[model samples]
Structure formats: C-alpha cells, structure tokens
Target: MDNTFARCEDLVFSYDDESRDVLCDVSLSFKRGEFTAVLGHNGCGKSTFAKHLNAILLPCGGSVYVDGIDTKDEERLYDIRQRVGMVFQNPDNQIVATIVEEDVAFALENLGVPPEEIRERVDEALKSVGMYKYRMHSPHQLSGGQKQRVAIAGIIAMRPECIVLDEPTAMLDPIGRREVLKTVKRLNREYGITIILITHYMEEAAMCGRVIVMDKGKVLLDDVPKEVFSKVELLKSVGLDVPQVTELVYELNKYGLGLDQHIITEEECTEALIKLLS
Candidate 1:
C-alpha cells in the first residue's frame, strides 16, 4: 500500500557547527513513476537535496529513505544507490569509457553483471537514449547532449527504478538541451522510471507533472506545475521565473485582458487567447 518511492522526513543538514543548515526540515515524498522537477535559484540547496537522494550526502538530522531503506543505515547504502541513480550536470565528468557502448556498460560491469547480459542491456540502453548508432564511437567525439545521453544510458543499463538528475541540461546548448530533456521525458513515460530533475530553466520545469521550489534550504512550493508556476509574484520574489507563456498571460491580465494565468506553453497561451476572443 505504500506508494512512495522516496521520502525525506524532517531532513536537516549543515556543513559545520557554526554554519547555518544547508537544508532544514525538508520533508517531502515522491510517488513511484512520477516525474517531479525541483527548481530554485543558485545556492538554494537544490543540489544539496539531490545529493541526499542517493546517499552522496547524509542528513545531519531526521532521515532520508529510498523504498523505505533509510539512507542513514550504512548497510543499505549500496541498495539505496542502486534504487535511485544520479546523473550530475556535466557529461564530461561522468563519461569514464572512451567508447559509447563501453561507457554504457560501465555500471553493469561494476555490479558484476554477466558479460552477455551487459552487452544486451548496454545496447538497449544506448538505443533507448538514441545513441546506439554511435555505440562504437568515442564519447569525446559526441556532442554535449549525446554524451549526456550516454551518461544516462550508463545509468539505464544499471536498471535503477529512479533517476535523480542535477541540472543535466545546464551545460548544453539549446539543441543539446532539447535532446537531453526529450530523452529524459521519454525515459519517464516509456520506461515508467521515476524522475527527479533539478533545473533552473522554467521551460523544463513546466514539463514536469509536479514542481517543488526551494529557497534558503526550505521548500517554498509543492504543487502541480500549473499551481506552482501561477504564483508569478511569489516565484519572482524568491528569484525564480514563471514559464514564458505564463508571463505573457500575466501581462495580458494586467492590461485587463482576462487570460488563463496557468498556461505553461506558447501553444496553451494561443488556445486561451483564441477562446477568449470567441
């Protein structure tokens, strides 16, 4: 009956005694197969939260649990990490193997999976991310997005039930960003993998079903994307942006044109305006 795939109970973390908490009373939970976006300005402890997902950082107070396995339990550490894989910001930093397929197979190899199974899973992972054609090529030759996909493939081959990405698109150009984002979305939809994406891009956050906004180590908003992003003034006050389409609708409303303030995309904005005109 327990549907929560991840949970943080009154989580608190601090670097040192004199330093204030980087995360304070951060209690939250995510359902299995849900795609959730975590958004905040720089130094808001978003990354710090991501690290706690896979036990990269332990809570100084309270506790974090992955599938009911507490992260504070030393024995469950590996089990927790295997259940929730992490993909960091930089693809270059993650790619260990020179060749694409080799990189994809890296994690499986580390886990002592059979060589034949590794090959099969590696191929599937690479193809799932749309990088199978470059399987034999060196990762250094691939574009930023392709490399990021490869990094994801490596995680996919591990068959983790969830992925926690910390600004995976931050280092990519527009095209690369699109590729990585699309890939992650597909992974969530087609594979039923839980996704926790940390991003500053309002557009990217708009794509998620749920959004969590944090500031100064505390969660400020937790709701569906529409409700979370509709608070234009509050989001701005905390140094975050609403989606462009939401902003456009807000401006139109300010000028006395009634429009749906929750529109998250240009297509939705156009539809609302058309309906308003009719």
Candidate 2:
C-alpha cells in the first residue's frame, strides 16, 4: 500500500566481501508522512541502515522496498532514489554549485527535468527551506546553517516522497543544528514529507514521533521518544545518551525525587521538578 512508503526485511550488509554484517536482520517500515529518528552510538549501523532506504547500498541477504518497488532491482535504482532523498553530515560535501539556487536545481537538471519545471521546483524548494532569499548568493558566503539548508533544498527540489538525513546536524554548531532541524520539521508538518533522521543528538530524536535505537548492527529499541528515553540504564549501557532534561529527571528519580522518568524535554523536566518542590 502507498500508505506504507518504505519497508526493509531481514536486511544484512557488510564491507569486504560480506565478512561481517553492519546491519543484521534489520527489518523496519515507514508509513507515509511519518517523522522518525534513528539513534545510536558510533559504529552502530544507523548510517548503514539509512543508506539502504535510498539504495545507496544494496542489501546483501534481504530486501528493501521503497514505495513498493524493490531496492535490489537494478532497473529500479533511479525510481528508488527519486522517492527517497538523502542528506548527509557535511553540507560542504553536498553543495557542488556556486550559487544557492543553482545547487538546488542540480539534481532535477541531471534527471532531465524540463528547464521551466526545474526552475519552479528549485524556487519552491528554496522557499521551503527558507533559503530563497539567498538564491543568487555564492554558497561560499553562506554560514554553516545556511549552507546545510541549501543542501536540504537541493534534496527537496528532487521532489522525493521521503528524506533520510544521516547525522545532518553533526557537523553544525548549535545554531546550524537548530536551522536544519527546524527546516526538516517544517517539511514534515507542512508538506507531509516522510522524515527519517539519523542523529546522535538525543534532543533531536526527542522531537520525532518515533525513535529507533540501534546497537551492534541491530535495533535495540523502537518506540515513542518518551518510552525509548525512559530506559536510562539501558541506553547508557550501550554508550548512548538521553536528552539532557531526561537525564536530569532520571538522576533526580534516583535521589527520591520521584519525577517521571519519561520526561524527554526541558519543559517536561522543569514542570516535574516544580511539582516535586511544591
């Protein structure tokens, strides 16, 4: 069904002739317009899993279906890529054009989209990412946050059904991180684009509708953010962290504060602390 935009079954992959699996029996599904975050410590295969969504890496022993088309089908690679756009850690690496708008139009142009349509798409995508006013400016002059937004606009110009961002904010400062995160959330809310964000930042994961935590090439937890972050010990055991607010509440709970361990945001933790004091 189209309602389910992406699906992966028993996905297995490894480098160097399949000697070891980076992703082990990983099966997940994404419904249309869902905003989900994937989290894990380093070398946990979260990025590897993201690559499979857009066919950057084919599954070794299983299948990945994007919009019901199999990713393993060599003939359908283009179709699969068109449906799921990928954004990566470094904006500098993704931005290839001199001007912002030209960069956004690059992908569609490569696809041989008509010039008129490419222009229209580029304008819309730039506006969506709040980068339209910088359209003609050289990308070298933009800030890190602005550059990353331009990169996102390029992906949006391709008109993909879903966007898979692998640590998109990792290379950014706080402001840059906020900018990219805000743009992605807006895309999900306004345009109903499915979002799969792979992030090391727990606060970013807290904003998503669902969280999937991977460890040692396998999914360790899959649930709503509050539920996933509540397992403080479990997450810490695997070298991962909860949002700062969640960690604060978790520590308070250990000291007889009796605060809800499920708090994932600063507001929630603050309210809980106030209630305990009262």
- Per-residue lDDT of candidate 2, residues 1-278 (tens digit): 45899999999999876577899999899999999999999899998899999889998889999999999898988998988999989989999999899999998989999999999999999999999999999999998999989998999998889999989988899999999999999999999999999998898999899999999999999999999999999999999988889888888778887778889888887788788788
- Model 2 misplaced stretches (Cα beyond 4 Å): none
Could you tell me every candidate's TM-score relative to the true structure?
0.97, 0.97
**Ten consecutive residues with minimal summed lDDT in candidate 2?**
12-21
After TM-score superposition, the amount by which residue 239's alpha carbon in candidate 2 deviates from its true location, in angstroms, is 0.6
**Top TM-score hit:** 2
lDDT of 1 by residue, 118-170 (tens): 88999899889999999999988999999999999988988899999999999
Which regions of candidate 1 deviate over 4 angstroms?
A: 276-278
* lDDT of all predictions: 0.92, 0.92
